[model samples]
Every structure is written in structure tokens, then in C-alpha cells.
Target chain A: MFDPEAIERIRAKQRAWEARELREFLARQPESRADCRTGSGLPVERVYTPADIAATSFDEIGLPGRYPFTRGPYPTMYRGRLWTMRQIAGYGTGSDTNQRFRYLIEQGQTGLSVDFDMPTLMGYDSDDPRSLGEVGREGVAVDTLDDVEALFDGIDLEHISVSMTINPTAWILLAMYVALAQARGNDLGRLSGTCQTDILKEYIAQKEWIFPIRPSLRLVRDMIVYCADHLARYNPINISGYHISEAGATSVQEVAFTMANAIAYVEEVTRAGVDVDRFAPRLAFYFVAQADFFEEVAKFRAARRIWAKLMKERFAAARPESMRLRFHCQTAALTLTKAQPMNNIVRTALQALSAVLGGAQSLHTNGLDEAYAIPSELAMKLALRTQQIIADETRVPNVVDPLGGSYYVEALTNRVEAEVGEILKKVDALGGTVKAIEEGFFQREIADSAFEFARRKASGAEPVIGVNKFVEPPEPNAVPVHKVDPEVEARQIGHLRAVRAKRDGTRVAALLDRLAREAADPGVNLMPVTIELVKARASLGEIVGRLRQVWGRYVETPVF
Target chain B: MPPIRVLIAKVGLDGHDRGAKVVARGLRDAGMDVVYTGLHRTPEEVVAAAVQEDVDVLGISLLSGAHMTLIPRVLELLRAADAGDMLLVIGGVIPDEDVPALLALGAADVVLQDTPPDAIARRVRELVAARQPR
Candidate 1:
């Protein structure tokens, strides 16, 4: 055993040698001063040593799967299993999307992610007068459980994980999923998936909300409690920053606003008398990995550290699982360019690499044609292959947190945390995220940021490769755009009409009436009634319209 | 002249509204009245809003690739409401091959995101001008 003083002396000498080498390297290229900054614009330094990490202790920044899991939530991480490969799927009707789902699974996709059409997301039926012409056009339209049953027809509920990107009426969709699982004879406890039931972000970024803030929050809490009690494997709320970042918030605002919303959810559910440890474990997050490689990496790392710390300190979660912030990521669709559409493949691949390196549990890569339209099958295959290449070929996941402890990355991580901390404080001061959203704080911030990014692109400060710089005029004849089935709407409407004509209309009406009464009951959880309504073949518009009758639709009161 | 009132709505389940919001804001900035009927609006609601607001134009945005289906329904609603005089415009991630068909189906014009807001506004003004017989 060596003496402590001797060991200390050896370490100091080693540090001095590294400094000397770095100084010599920098001196050789004096013009290339290693100035550093985070993706969110916070300044960073070229080097960090004991002086920088002096305050961080073993207790504060512990080992993987330990308290305050700054490094990672899992012990083995990707060494044991690769991140879940979930490609966002939905197009045409439920049956069409169902086939796509089965195809994706056969192609080695580990999980399923559903993209709903505008009418479905807005809680309208396929045949709703307003929903006409739009059914299954943008995404799969599911007006009733019949559609949901068709969407997951061949898929075994117990085996595959599903993620539904629906909000506002998330409870309705979740009910559909549960009913489908029940019909399949799968134990609800065994079935797993995620509902992006984040209402605050809906107000902040997506704007697909139906109820006013308080009631919307009540519904969110209801799902959290219900899922925690019933379907323990399911992720109740996927607190999302993807839309926020895509909608134009900077990386810092994306993380800050997302965390603020997450905090709001935590506070609300806790206020509703649910124990934090019971449900926090299943609470997942969805974030965007943008073009900024290292910054995006740092944001992910910082998010983990901050969330773990919050869980331990703020919520006092006893379970390590509760503290572990499991997240799913998708490459930023906003960063993809319609000009040089091919470049998007590279853009998506790089963003996805950042997500894996940053330790995401699940990931989706955007198709190259996303900026132009819904991705053609060819483009989608390429997107899936990009993730496969990164996983199998790159060997990036060979080491856990491969970019961990890099001077630039660590410094960037610290800077991002500092900036986001300031934002969180502001959100907290505004009486939390709900009040801030109601007051239009988050929306105003995103709009301003979006405007800035656009202005920057126009002024040539931020270069958009094909859009601004390196412009190449597209050839007169490029790839033919993918054609959607023009008859899709007519066909879907016909099917819906037949379903309505054949189903006992009186039974459907009675079920809907029961739903209306249950929704009106403040104490009554609407999920059960929603399940009954869906089982009775009640359409989405009727279900949401009923709730809308009880809880009037939200009118945005602009906070000036 | 009173502000050029425009009603914007997403007819189907395409929840992508970034373009819709940007265009709404741009039109508002361009001294036009903009009312965004948030996602999943029915054609009936849109037509009623157009009739009630007496808007000069209706701009519909869809990213759900459902514009082909959704646009015709909105047009039919307009015709039913006898508000066909109000110009109907559409935009979103539409395929170039589908543009002519959408126009033929009664859309005054199909604007893509790549097209500048000013160009779209100018087109709106032109349609309004043409409707007035010079």
C-alpha cells in the first residue's frame, strides 16, 4: 500500500503533465483559442479540473443507478441492451397504420410510436363535419375503439411497447389502448406504452388542448394516479420538450420549460394526494435531439442530473426507480431541410448519435423527407437503418456515457444547467408552470425565440446549409413526391358510416350519456367511462364533445 | 379598410401547427384579422366561423397529409353555408403532384411553407381584387 501523500504527489504530477501537453498543443495553434460555450449560449471553458468539480461530491454526483444518478440511470446502460428503437408511425386509416406497425416490428423496430391525425388529436371523429377530408390523411384516425382494435390487430399487447403521441384527450386514447389490451386477453399490468399526456406543454408549445388549465391538470393527475395503480408497466405521462424545442424554443428553454412542466405535474399529482414514489418511476420524458451535437449531448446529461437531484431533494422520492428519469428522444424534425432533403439523413443520424451518447433509453430518427411531407417508405426505411447503423456499426454504445467526463462536454453540461436553473427559478416565481402557461410566459418565450431563430437565418448569423448557404438549385426532375391514396377519406368515411349504421345507435347514445354524467362528476375519473364509451363504439368527436359540454373548451386569454 | 379577417383551422388529426401559427401571426402582422380555430376543428365550425366573422378569406393548414380529404369538406361546408364567395386557401406538407387537384377541388390557392408569407398575402389580395371585378 502506498502512502496517501505519495499518491497525492503522483496525481499532481500527472495533472501537471497533461496541462503542459495541452498548453503546448494550444500554443502551436495560437489562433485557434479553445473558447467554449453550451448549445444554449452559456460560456464554457476549454479545461475543467478538480477546481471546477470541487463542489461536486460523491453524494451529489453518484455512480450509475445510484442516488443523484448524474452519470446515468442504469448501471450497465447500452452494454446490456441497446436503446429502444421506436420509429413514429401513422398514415392513412387505423388498419393501414396497423400494417405499418407490424412491418416496422418485423424490420427490427423494438417499440411502436403512433402519430394521430389532426382531427383525432383535436378530439374529432373521422366523420365529424369539420373532420371531413382530413381523416387518416396526416396520421391514422381512430374515432372509436374499433379503429384502435384495428390499429393493433395482429400485434400482441404483452410483447410490444407502444407510444401514442396524443394529449388533451390522452385519457380517451389511453382508455382505448387499455380496452384493446383487455380484448386481447393480455393482463393490463403486462401491457406497456406511453401516452404523451403533457397538458402544460400543450399550452406552451403544441396548443392542442381542450379544457382550461385547472381541469386539464386534473385529467393529467387522474391518468397518473390511475396508471400507477392499475397498469404499473405503462408510462402515464411523457413530459415532452420535443414540441417545445421544435416550436422554436432554444435548447435551454426546451429543457427549462420541460422541467418546469414536469415539476408542475409532480406538484399537481402530489397535491391530489398521490405519493411521488408510487408514480414517478413510470413518468417518462420525450425530448428533441437537434443539430447541435455536443450541446444536445450536454443537455441530455444535464437533464438527467437536474431531474435526479429534484426527485431526491424536492419530491423526496424513496425509490431509486422514482429518481431515475427515463426519457425517449427523437431527432429534431425542425432541423431537417426541404431544400437539400437528402442532407436530412445526415442531420438525423448525427442528432440520434448525440441522443445515444447522452444516454437516452429510447430513440426515433426522423425521415429525410420529413421537412417536405410525410416520409415515403423509402425514407422511413433509411431512417430506421440510420439507427441500426449507429447501434451495430458505430460501437458508440460500447461504453456507457462514452462522452462523459470530456472537458468540453462537461463544461457545456454545467453551463446548460446554470441557464436552465435560472429559467426554472423564473417559472417557479410565476407560481409554477401552470400559472406561467396561463399567463402566456412559456408561449411568449417560445414565440420570441422562434422569431429570433428565423431572423438569424435571414441575417446569415445562423447558417441553414441548403436554405441559406451552399445553395444548389434543385433539378427540374427530382424524386417524385409520394402520393397519398386520394380515396382514403371517402373509404374511411364509408367504413365509419357502416359502423354507425350497424352498431346499436341507442346503445352508443346511452354509453355516451353515461360518459357525459361521469365527466361532469369532478370526483369521477373519466378513464373508466371513456373505456365504456369506446367499447360501445362511440366516436372520438362524440366522446370529446361530451366532455367539452361539461368542461367548456379553452379560449386562449393572451397574456400581454 | 377594415382588417382582412381570416379564419385558420386544422380540419383533421394533423397536430402539426407550427406553419399554421407562423402564417397566422404573419397575416396578423400584415394588418389582417387572424382567428386560429385550434386543432381538430370540424368543417361546420370553420364554415360557421367564416359566416359569423364574415371573414374575407379562410386559410386552412394541414400537416397530417390529409389536406386532400379535409380541403374538399371545408369547401363543401362553405358552399352549404353560401359562403363560397369567401376565398379558401390551403397550406402544409402537400405534395406537388396533389397541388393541381387541390386547386381544382375549389381551393383558391395551395401555398407551401417554402413560399414566403408576403407572397401568400399578396396572392390573397390578388384573389380579393379579382373577386371585385377590377
Candidate 2:
């Protein structure tokens, strides 16, 4: 990046300036902190000179679309085609969510990301007593093929791309999607979307896991094989770093831990007789765009480099696309404040910009009222408008990796990559992600980081403007939040009963029995068989229940 | 006597337990007894634990909008279980419109996400002050 002699001379001059000018200025006005660091607590130098990125050269940080693609993935990047504007949305019953999905598409949203309710997410049916109140509060409730069909009711499967944010029952929903597409006469090869089948992260962060580690990985493997053979365009698993960050991981930990899970998935798929290159290109990531602007940009760049290195060096991936780490980014929901609810609008816009500058393949800008309830229609429209404003008005996307050669960005990128590499080595030494998870490694780490952050906020050291620093009286009359109707749960249960009564109960039972038998045999790909069961009106709970007989439930180890 | 026994339990299927855990840790650090039932506990199980533990206060955190159903059930269970005297403090992404209903359902306090940890401790202390003269 810089000549050796010039870097040496610059370092000497910087030291001289710090000794004289910095000391004199500091004597009059002391620095805010004794030292400055990035959001991840990595120490930052006062001034990043050529000396910092002295070893870097053009080949290492080459143009976009090249190997070790630290800058960007595509050649022209946003100039060629802007990143997909995919807003995550779902609530109430499937039919209710179907309306919301249709609205988003009409609003010019480029992609669709589905958020399932707790009952559906945990693989439970609407009628289960445990799922009594939680049928459709958080997201849409999908219990059978009928729900999935209703959810995607009027949407064109060929045009829109969907990302399902589910893990424990991801494979079941994927089967439902395939069945729905087949029933619609849509080409299975052309169904573009991603199923978040990454179960390891569920145990580490979100705590929504159903089966134990080994068996869950087995399900993930089976889905990968099925997707590779059938749906070439759809991603079987979105190895998520988003939950890790939301659960209190540092940016570097988010990258390292997520990539660790990706490696575990790759190892599983390969060990299941599939080649790494065959499935690696379809592997995608989901990350959080936190409040730190430059740090978020550098984190994405470093993640790409680390992923490329991992695929090429370790797995010996054959194709160039196999080494590319294509990912979807969501604005950090943790950064949104419940206080001054309108301020969240600004926070979301800033985070959305960070995601765009970071070159995310897809983006989901959270709604302003998300901290209170499901977003109101007005709020969702405003969020979509924020993305549109950035895409249309902003000229930042005209060039690729616009900040590729900055001293500060390059140094931070290297620092993040090196720290994430260290964490990966630690994960590797602990045997793998599975063993580390069993030992509560990731959970403990996230807890410690979370506690540290909470401590900082409590002490008023890290001042959040609307929360800790600026106090405000409650606004008695505030934003109108979208609420799930009380009738939604009852209606969903009634629909479930109707489906059960209308379908051949005896036939459904026999298909479930066959499903249970096939589930016991690890060699079977449950997608096709599950599709048959769903076609016969066998509900999600029934199939998952049969497998639960074999796989058993997962109880998380307490971290606090 | 002993510190104020508080059971911080997560009700229903919401997996975002970070707030509950943070409040539990803060309460524990404030010299109170805090027992977390981990994630996905039903209302019946929560009330049963409240009765069995004989906790002075039961703090149930819910973010998945299941509170309208779960909170009323827990209150009913507490009354049926003869544990109606227990104070219930609810927290997490609860809508402003739902606050009055939650309070009418016998919640001692409806704490929003923006409330500080120390404020939570102080509120709990004030709530239990009258009954602590044993």
C-alpha cells in the first residue's frame, strides 16, 4: 500500500507530532478516554498511518470478484445491480401474513424474508397446549401444508426470493415449500430462497433448538444433500452470525463463530458423501449490521477474506464461486431503543446505510416500532422508504469498495480478520463447534461479553443517547403498534381442526407412521417423504413428533 | 431475614431471554434471591414454580406478544393455587395499550425495556416493604 522508506519516514514524523502537538493539545483539552478502541474493544491507534497497512499490497486486497475477495463479491458490485431489499415480516395466521407479504412486494421490496411464530418455529402444532397462547403472536403460524400455501398464497414463486428464518423445524418448512411449489406447478429448480437450517447457532445463541447436537446436524446434512440434488438455486442453510451478535457477541466473534458453524456444516455434508464444491457455493451467511459504521464495513470485508482462505486452503474448494461468501445483512435490532421510539427511525437508517456500504447481498431494515410490537403498516413503509432513499439518492454505491484503501479501514480490516482467525483456532482446538457448544464455550463467551456491555451501560461509561444519557418523560400517547388479533389463535386452531376433519385421518396417520419408520433410518432424505406426508395432510407437529420419538428433545445448559 | 426471593421466569415460546437473564443478574447483584427457570416455561409451570419456591415476587418476561394470554393464565393459576399474594412484575416488548390490562390483571409493576436495573430493584423493594416485617 505504501513504499517502505515512505512508511518509515511517516512513522517517525507521526511520533514527533504525537510527542509535541498531541501532548500540547491534550494538556489544554484531555482526550475523552485514555485510549480509543473499536466497538469490539479492539484497541485503535490515534492515527492509522501508512505504517499500519504497510505489508498490504494490491494482490492481497485485489479488485472485486477476484480470489480473496475482501473488497466485494461481484465485479461491478452495486453499479451492476443493487443489493436485494428484503424486509423480514410475519405475524398472526398464515392468511394474515400472506397479506403482509403481498403488501411488501407491492411496496417494491426486492426479496421476502419470512419470520415464523413460536409454535411453528419450535415445530409444534397450533393445538398443542404448550403452544396455546403463542400460535401467531410473534410471526405467522404454519402448522400444515395449508398454512404454507396460505402464507405464499398469491405470490409469484418464480419472481420473488424468500428467506425463511427458522432452524429447529427448517427442514419441515423447506419440505412444505417444495410441496407448495410442486403443487403450483412451479419449477423446483427455479425456487430461489434460503432455509435457515443452521441448528448449531440455535443452541449457541437463540436457544430454539429441538433435537440434540448430533441428530440436528444429521437433519442439516440431509437437507443439504436434498437441496444440492434438487433445488440448485436455493440455499439449504444460512449459517447465521446475526443471532450471535444479537446475543452479545463482539463483531469478530460473530464472524468467527458463524464461520466455525459453516465449517462444521461443510464437514458434515462432505462426510455424507457430497463434495465440498458441490454444496459450498450455495452456503450463505446472515449477519447483523451494528451501530459502528466503519467497523461494520471492515467486518464484512474481513469476513470475506477469512471465508475465502478457509474454503481454498482448508477444504480445497474447486470453483471460485465456492470461495465467495455471499450473505444477507439485517440492521442490528439490539441497537433500536424503546425510549424516544421515533429515534429508532434514525438508528435504523444509519444501520441500513452501514449494511449497504458493507456490500451485503441482501438487507432487512427493521421497522421503527419493532421494539414495541410487530411493525405497523406505516412503520414498515417508512423502513422500506429508508432503503429506497439510500439506494436511489445516495451515490456511495456508484463504485465498488469505495473505502478499500483507507489506512484506518485497512488496518481495522486486518485486525478483525486476525482476531477472528484466533477465535477459529480456539474453536478448532476444542475439537469443533459441536464439542465447543457442548462445553458451553460460545454461550459463556457471549454471556461474559453481554455482562461486560451491561456493566458499561449501567455505569454510564458507554452513554446511549436516549437510554442512559438523555432522560425523557413517558409519552402517554405514542406510536400505534400492530397487534395480532386475539381471534388469530382461535381461527388458526379452528382451521387446523377443519383440515384434520376434512382430510383422510386414517391416511394421514399411516403416512406419519411411514415417516417415523423412515426417520429412524438415517439414510433416508426426509424432504421427499415429508412432502408425501404433507401432501396427505400430515401436519408439521405429527412429523416432528414422530422424529422426536427417535431424536429426543434438547435442553440447553444454563449459562447465567 | 433473608433477601427478597425473586423468580425470573420466561413464559411461553419467546427465545429472547437476554433481558430476563440481565435483570436476574442485576437483582442477584442487588442482594436478592433470583431463580431463572430458563426458556419456554408454560404459565402453569411458572405458577407451580412460584408456589413451590415460595418466591416473594415472580418476574415473568415475555416479548413474543403472548402476554395477553400467558399473563392472565398465570394470574389465574396463582389465585387457584392460593398464591395470590405473590407480586408479579412483567417486562419486555409490551405495548403501551396492553399495560393497563396487564396492571388490571394484578401485576405489581409493568416494567418497560428502557427501565434501568437499579430502578427495577428499588421498585421491588418498595413493593415488598410492607410485607417484610417478619
For each candidate, give the interface RMSD after superposing the true interface residues on Cα. 3.4, 1.3
Each candidate's DockQ score against the native complex?
0.34, 0.68
lDDT of each residue in A1-560, candidate 1, tens digit only? 23556657766875896689867966787644345445455666555554454444446455677766667789989988899999998878889998888888888999999988767888877776666666676688877778888898888888989999999888889988988888878899998899999988988888787788888888998898889889989999999999999888889899899999999889988987788999999999989998789899888888988898788888998888988888999999988877878888889999999999988999999988886667677788889999999999998888888777665676677778888899999988898887788788988888777766655665666678887789898643244455567677787787778878777889889888887777676676777777887887777788888878888988775321
State iRMS for model 1.
3.4
Q: How high is each candidate's TM-score?
A: 0.87, 0.98
lDDT tens digits, residue span A1-560, model 2: 67889999998999899999998999999987887778899998777878999998877788899999998888999999999999888888888888988898899999999999898889899999889888888888999899988999889888899999999999889989999999999999999999998899989999897888888898899899999999999999999999999988989899999999999999988887889999998999999999888899999999999999999999999899999989899998888877788998899899889888888999988888878888888898999999999999988889898888889999899999999999999999999999999999999898878777788887887777788888787786568878668888889999999998899988888888887788788777778788888888888888888888988898876767
In model 2 chain A, the worst 10-residue window by lDDT is A475-484
Where does the lowest 10-residue lDDT sum fall in candidate 1 chain A? A49-58
- For every candidate, give the share of true A-B contacts it also has: 0.46, 0.59
Give the clash count for each candidate: 16, 0
Error of 2 at A114 (Å): 1.2
lDDT of each: 0.81, 0.89
lDDT of 2: 0.89
